[model samples]
Target chain A: MTSVQIEVFLQTLIAGLLLGGLYALIGLGMTLIMGVMKIINLAHGELMMVGMYIAYWMFVLFNIDPYLSVFIATPALFFLGIAIQKFLVNPVLKVESILPENQVILTVGIGMVLANLATVFFKSDYRSTPVAYATNAFYLSDFWETSPIELSLSVPWTVSFVFAVVITITLWFFLAKTDTGKSIRATAQDLEAAFLMGVNVKLMRVITFGIGAGLVGAAGCLFLPIYYLFPSLGGQFTLIAFVITILGGLGSTIGAIIGGLVLGVFESMTATYIGMGWAPVGRFVIFVVCLIFLPGGVASLLKRKKFGK
Target chain B: MKKFAPFIILTILAVIPLTGLSTYMLHILILVIMWSAIGMSWNLLGGYCGQVSFGHAAYFGVGAYTAGILYSKLGLSPWWGVPLSIVVVSVFSLVLGFIVLRLRGPFFALATLASGEVMRITTENLVDLTGGAMGILIQKRTWVDKTWYFYIILLIAASTFILVRKLMESKLGYYFVAIREDQDAAESLGINTTLYKTLALCISGVLTGIAGAFYTNYMGYIDPHVAFALHDISIITIMIVMVGGVATYWGPFVGALIMVLLAEVIRSMPGLGTAHQTLFGVLLIVIIIFLPNGIVGDYKKLKRLLGFRRAST
Candidate 1:
């Protein structure tokens, strides 16, 4: 390949990796919720949208940085998640319905309300946080003096990627070392056993939902500086998170991380090789292939390798 | 009395146009019947078979596009789409069922949702075949009057009601309910769960496609967004079944009437137009929590909630 081609490839790879970090964070929230609740939260993307709006308003009204708003939005979403679980989802769980997919449908209703409310309040306008450093980028040529190929990285993208990594590390530590986290994991593994062992499985479900919401909320804040925001944007992200969870294997954090990166790279490649409009199609293609060939997802592969060893 | 109830309702609906209702009211009535047809089809799979699809829009859109393509490309009458859609959507559903039927519960729902989106995206991109996002418009509508359109939809809805009722009373219906109740147990009892599930999907998909074909002809327009709308077509289909009654013959009909009227009322209000989805969402949440089985399925609960008491024993 020509030097220009190489440069383009490298640039795409960098962009994909940066985007993957945030995707992993989004997938992590969904997998966690699915593990504990045993139901897919269709409103997961709308919750993130709510977080983005909070960040957007904070930036517009108070000149607060989007990064700082993460601290504010995450907790807000945590409470919102708790309330939804306690009131809307909890009541439906007790009701006897012909279709056991009632909780999933309820989440869809929640998503519709959230998306519609945003449209009403925000007028369906696309907004973005215009940080002073939004356009600032570091050129590889400037640093290498005589580099063979040119490469540039956007400041906001790198910052978001770094923040995503830091947050993921913190989450890992909390899950591994914390008592409540262990209880949550135990409940996810076996609800009956957890309950029998005196774990508050119900409380764990609620808290897991909250944490899932909060994680996605943080992701929304991180994405704000780099991506444009709109009310209808939630549906696409919800699909993305779902695709990641399926590819990563349901409820597997490591699988989600690997799945996110693979998806990001694949999507970036499709955008580059095919047309921009086909990126979403690429996502579904991966999803269908995963379902057909790798039903257990990346986690199953990991499990198989571990067993083989 | 219960057996005659359907015939009585059909007779009443048939004579409504003769009553000389206003065109606007006729339009609403047509929509209610059309939605009921769609809801009944959904109920066949979701309510009885227990496969809650979040992507009925895939079949709906395909059925619509089948008609649109016939009219625009083949220079044929769009009405032919109504019958042709059964063939097209059956094959489509069979293929779709092969992939998605393996999944149970929420996974199946999401897979179907993805398929619907994929169809929409494909339709939008394939400009030559589908006219892309520009949409297909039947320049000369078959009829400017609402009477014929209303009659056609009513016919479709009535037939759908009969078909669903018949299916539910047959052996296939028993198998569907059995699968819904427990897949493993059904399999152990010698029921081919996949085959039955696919059968349900095919029947449901074909019925929905017919409604979609009718929509294209009645509305004289077809677009990716209008045909394959996730919230509007797919979710509303679910809501119609959920709010009316799941696994009940009259559920979709009642749900359609209520939802159609509610939509009209909400849309008519000037300030509340943008918040219609919020109302729909709230209504769905409330129905799921309180009724669960829907208005018709939980009739006694609904009556009791309204403070109706049984006569003293």
Candidate 2:
């Protein structure tokens, strides 16, 4: 291939990786909730949307940087998640329902309420944070004067990616080293065992959900400067988070990271090669392929390899 | 009286148009029947088989597209799409079933939801055949009156009612309930869990597809958004069964009636139309928590909550 072709491919790859960092943050939240609650939070995207709106208003009203608002939004979303779990989801869990999928359906209702209420209050108009550095990018050719290919990275994208990486590392530290985090993991692994071991499983569930919502809220803040916001945007992102979870393996943090990166690259490649509209179809293709051939997802593959070794 | 209840209800519904209701009322009646048909289909798979699909829109859209394409391309009457959809949706469901039926519970639900979005996106992208986002509009509508549409949907609803009743009564129905209650136990008992699940999916999909085809003929317009709406079509189908009663036969019917009328009442109210989903969501939360079995399924609980007491013996 020509140097120009290589340059374009490299650019796309870089873009995909940057996008994947944020996607990983989103997927991490979903995987955590799925792992601990044992129920798919269909309202996950709406929580993210709530985060985005919080960031948007912060930017619009107080002139706060979208990144800076992440602090505010994450906490707000944490409370919202706790409230939802305690009042709506927890009660349903105790109820004798004909369908085991009732909790999932309840999340759907929550999502609808969130998205619709956003429409009512926000007027459904697409909005974005017009940050000062929105279009600012660093050119690779400027630094490497003798480089064969030119590359440019958007300031917002790079900053967002850095923030995502930092947050992910911190989360890893928390999950790996902290007592509450260990309890959460134990609950996710085996609910009964965790409870028998004297761990407060219910509190862990509530805290895990809060953490998941907080992470996704941070993602929303990161995405605000780069992506358009609307009420119905929650549905699509929720699906994206879900696809990532399934692709990575249900409730596997590391798997979610890998799945997010894979999805990001695949979606960017599809957009570059085919058309923008077909990018979602590409996501579904990968999902179906994963379901059929690799039912256990990347986590299972990693597990099998470790077992073999 | 219990045995004759369905017949009695059908008879009353069949003559509703004879009361010479306004066109708007007839339209609402048609919508209620159509939703019930979709709900019954969903009830079979979700309520009976325990496979709660969040993507019935995929089958529904395919059915509508099947009918729309026939009229648009083959010059056949759109009514032919109903029967043709049974075939098209069955094949589609079988293929989808192969992939999704492997996953149980919530995983299956998400997979089906993805499939619906995929179908919508596919149709939206394939502009030449499906008319893309512009949608297909029938040039010559079969009738301007609402009575015929009402009758047609009523007939479809009745047939779906009968078919579901028969299926649920037979050995197949028992297999479905067994699988729903406990798939592993059912398998241990030598029930072909996968086959029965697929069967449930096919029957459910075909019935929903038939309703979708009817929707196209009734509405005289076919669009990817309208036919494959996640919230409008698929969620409403779930809500019908969920709000009415999950496993009960009468659940979808009563749920459809309440939901359809509730939607109309909400939408017609000044300044409240835009917030209808919020209200629906609240209702859903209340039903899930307080009446998890739905109105019909948890009638005793509801009656007790309402402070109704049985006469002293």
Candidate 3:
């Protein structure tokens, strides 16, 4: 490849890597919920939208930075998650229906209400948090005067990436160390087994759901400065999260992280090479391809390797 | 009364145009019939077969576009789309079923949903064939009066109702119910679950596609948004089945009437129009929690509750 071609490729890769880290954050919540509850949270993106709205209002009213609003939004989302689980989902779980997909349909309804209500109250406007350093960037040429090519890193993307890493590490530490976290994992492995082992499966389900909501809420806050938001944006992000969960092997956290990176890079590549409109198609191409060839997702491959079967 | 109820209702609907009702009312009736037709098609797959699809719009859009293409590109009448879509939608459904039928429950639902969205996006990008985002507009409409359109849709809806009823009474219907009750057991009983599931998907998809082709001719407009709508076409189809009653012959009809009337009433209210989806969402939640089997499915329970209330009062 020519110098310009190589530079373009490198630029796209860097941009994709930054985007992927954030995507992983979004996917993490969905994977966690699917793991513990054994139900896909179709309203995952709407919950993220709520978190973004909260951050937007905090920035507008209280003059707080988007990053700092994470602290506020996360806990609020945790409570919201608890309420939804207690009032809406738990009841449906007990309801006898021909179709076992009632919970999924219920989530779709919740998403519709959330999206429509936002449009009603917020007037369907595209919004963003206007941080002071929105355009602040670090240039490769500045750091290395003898550099052959130019590169710029936006301040917000880098900051978001770092925050995502830190949060993921914290999640790892908690899940690996804490008793509640262990119980949650145990429940995910085998619900009946966990119950037999004297773990409070009901409580763990609620807490896992809350943590999922809280984590995605933090992800929304991280995304606020870099991306624009509207109420309907949740639907697309919901698809993105769903795709990631599938790619990552249903409820596997590590798989979700890898799937997020793969999707992010692939999406950006299509946006750069193909026209922008075809990017969504690329996302689905990856999804359909994964479904057909690797139905068990990346986690299955990991399992195969570990088991040496 | 129960035995002759369908014929009586069909006769009443057939004669409604002669009543000199206003054009607006005729339009509403047309919509109600069309939606019920779509709902019945959905019910065939979702209710009896237990394969809930969230992307009937994919078939719907493809059907609309088929007719639209015939009129605009082939210089043929839009009516050709109705017959041709049977062949077209069956092929598409077979392909779609091959991929989606592998997954069960919510995964299947999600896969279908994505397929609808993918078709929309593909159509939007295929500007030459689909006219891009501008969509297709038939310069001439089939008729200026609403009566012909009403009768045509009514005919379609009636046939659909009959087809579903006949299918349900046959051995095929028993197979579907068995698969729904337990796939593993059905497989053990030598019922090729995959073949039956694929058959159900094709029938349901073809039926919805026919309705869509009818929609294109009736509306004289075909856009990716209107034809392949997720919330509007797909969700509403599911909602009809959900509200009316799953797996019941008359549920789709009842649900369609209520939903259509509800939409019209809500849309007429200037303030409540934007909040319609919120109401829909709340209704869905309440039904899932309280009714679970929809109005027709749980009407006995509903009536008992009402009777108890009357006794108390």
Candidate 4:
């Protein structure tokens, strides 16, 4: 391949890493809920959808910049998450005997409700912030030619990679060094023990769920300029998020980040080498292949190498 | 009880079509039968085995596309094509099940969702084989008329209901319930959970596939969007099952009758296209929250009012 081709390839790889960072941000909810509540929130994507809408409407109505609205929208969603967990999820959590599929059904029902509610309210229209920066791109260098050296390469981030990195790091810090974070970990590891320790297991579940939703809100804030927002858009990223959470391990926060990055990079590579439509095929292949080799998830795979399964 | 129940249902089913009803009512009846049958098929894996697949549309699509291809390309009779489609879809389900059966709970659901997506994408992409997204249309066959199609679907629907009834009474049915309740405990009791789950999926796939063929043949068209969409999974099958009542044979049948009829009726009214879907979504949420037992299950609580013994419990 020519140097111009190499430049384009490198640019795509870098873009994939940046996109993966946001994927990780959005996927934290699925993994966290699974870790603590042992319930996979199928509505996780739907929650993200609502967050996107909230951010979108905030932008449209108040003319607030997409990034700036995160401060308001994230807190609102956080409380919404807490309420849903406390009232809806808590009742189901008490069942001594719950099947995995039952959880899937309940969450699917919740997701359907949220998605259709959005559709009803928003009418399935696509929206994006009309900020001038939404379309800006930066060129790094030109590729060499035999005589003139004329070919060039450019990189684009409507979401801005800096904001994505910042959100990811903030989430990392929140999960690592807070009293609530430790309680969240305790709830995930030993639910009964956490309760026995007077950790208010119920409150912790609501709090963790809230934080998860808040992270997704942050993701939506980051995603508004990068991609168009719609109800159906939830379906697209939700699929990849599922794979990312599973590949990362159900409860591991850091695992979600790594898994998201890996899947995003793999998807970009597949879209580049194979085709755009086959991106899902690439995800499915990786999901199945990973399950075959690393059933506990990629986090376990990593831990196994460092210690042992 | 066994001798009279079938005879009673058969008599009622036969008498309904002959009533002085409008052609529109007949059309609605036919649709109810088909959708109820599809819902029952979904319940086999989802309601019975506790696998909650959101991808029954994949099997449904395969069935429709198979019959459409054979009838259009090879001039084969749908009679043969329909049965052949079921076999093909069952085998496909077996392969998919082998890969995905080990996945627990939401993971399994997500995997099935991905599979449905893959099928949709492939159908849209493989223009030569599946006619792409614009869809392939089939010329109506002269040998079988619309009434014949109606009866065939009705028979299939009744058969599906009876099959589910028989299975629920059998030991295999108990095994399914056991797996759904708790897999490890069931395994401790010597049930082969994997084998039973796979069997449920295979049955579910075959039934759904047959329904697909019947649907395509009835419409004389096949399309990827309608046949293999997540919307179909969520709205048609999952919603009907929940409304009908989980873990019950007749729940889907009753549920589809209500949900579909409501949708059709609402669509007739002006300015309800958008609200129509929201109504169903809100209905689904309300059903889950307030009427967790669903109509069929709730009926048992009114056994004295209905003057019938509570059979569900």
TM-score of each: 0.98, 0.98, 0.98, 0.92
The DockQ values of the predictions, listed in order, are 0.89, 0.93, 0.85, 0.47
**lDDT: worst 10-residue window of model 4 chain B:** B301-310
Q: Tell me the lDDT of model 2 at B133.
A: 95
Clashing pairs in 4: none
Runs of candidate 2 exceeding 4 Å displacement: B308-313
Q: How many collisions per candidate?
A: 0, 0, 0, 0
User: DockQ for the candidate 3 complex?
Assistant: 0.85
lDDT of 1 by residue, B63-131 (tens): 999999999999999999999999999999999999899899999999999999999999999999999
Give me the displacement of residue A309 in model 1, in angstroms: 6.6
Which residue pairs show collisions in model 3? none
List chain B TM-scores, each candidate.
0.98, 0.97, 0.98, 0.91
Q: Per-residue lDDT of B1-313 in model 3, one digit per residue for the tens?
A: 8999999999999989999999999999999999999999999999999998999999999999999999989999999999999999999999999999998888888888889989999999999998999999988987899999999999999999999999999999999999988999999999999999999999999999999999999999999999999899999999998999999998899999999999999999999999999999998999899888889999998899789999999
CA lDDT, candidate 1, residue B83: 96
lDDT of candidate 1 at residue A152, scale 0 to 100? 98
Docking class of 1: high
lDDT of all predictions, in order shown? 0.95, 0.94, 0.93, 0.78
Q: Worst ten-residue run, lDDT, model 1 chain A?
A: A89-98
Candidates 3 and 4 compared: the better one by lDDT is 3
What shift in Å separates residue B12 of candidate 3 from its native position after superposition? 0.8
Model 2 chain A weakest 10-residue run by lDDT: A89-98
